[model samples]
Target: MTQTLTLTWTTVCLLDRLEPDRGVAALVDGVQIALFRTADGLFAIDNRDPVSGAYVLSRGIVGSRDGVPTLASPLHKQVYDLRSGHCLDLPGVAVARHEARCRNGLVEVRLRQEG
Candidate 1:
């Protein structure tokens, strides 16, 4: 059986307002999410840096590693995959990644549910 999941998308800002290769912070349902606009596409992840306990992921440097979009934490410079939120520098550590899309020039974000 296939289960259907409903996602509530929150409109964050205008797509034109976001510059390419940069990140912005938004609060959805009391959770802080970091939204990134890269040449590849839009990506969302938790704003809190797991290494330094700092809510500064939005300020991370945006770049690519081996053709994969990545964000390096501003505090500790730990690179994280924007698509999977996996820490490339650390083993078995990851950040929460969310769904982000552009609809009618608006940037919307959907929080990913964790099991």
Candidate 2:
């Protein structure tokens, strides 16, 4: 596992701006990430495409399989787990999971280094 890097949380957009089944992209320390608001009003995953390194996860589609929320890569259709950063279609592969929360009516993502 890679050492966790402390990512200062930044409010990329307003909660009202993000609708269900849509996403927006933000750069946290040169790392491109996609923030998704699921159909259920919950947020998950960053848009870094591990398979292609395109950093276009935010532009990908959002949906669920077996009731698990998933984000598919825009470049390659690789699906990632929003909660665990696990790649659903690839074994032994994972993406960087950002610690995200809402505070003061704003959504914030803290990119922590994985242990």
Candidate 3:
């Protein structure tokens, strides 16, 4: 059986606005989200760094580690898996991951609805 994820996709920006292997910050559903377009694909995660508590993940470096796309925190260099939001530098710490993609020249991100 195929599994389906229930999510609301919101268009944040145009694909042309983003450069490859770079991150851009966007606000979706009142939450700060960092969007990245790497050689692998587009990925979205919480903008705030779990360690420093600063909203600056958008400035993080993008690279691949062990075949996983990752974003390293600019403030303290805490690396996080872009696909799973798992912190590499420090175990047991992680940022929230989101679904982000480019469609029809536009960037769209998934937002989790509040109860």
lDDT of 3 at 86: 92
TM-score sort, best first: 1, 3, 2
On residues 1-115, what C-alpha lDDT tens digit does candidate 1 reach at each position? 5543436999999999999988899999888999999999999999999988889999999999999999999998999999999999999989989999999999999888664
Determine which window of 10 residues in candidate 3 has minimal summed lDDT: 1-10
**Model 2 residue 113 distance off true place after TM-score fit, in angstroms:** 1.8
Error of 1 at 53 (Å): 1.3
Whole-model lDDT per candidate: 0.92, 0.75, 0.89
Strongest candidate by lDDT: 1
lDDT value, residue 11 of candidate 1: 96
Please list the residue runs of candidate 2 whose C-alpha ends up more than 4 Å from where it truly belongs after superposition.
1-5
lDDT of 2: 0.75
Off by over 4 Å in 3: 1-7, 113-115
lDDT of 2 by residue, 3-38 (tens): 666768877666777777887887766657778777
- The digit string of per-residue lDDT tens for model 3 on 1-115 reads 5544547899999998999888899999899999998888999999999999999999999998999999989998989999989998888999988888788999999964324
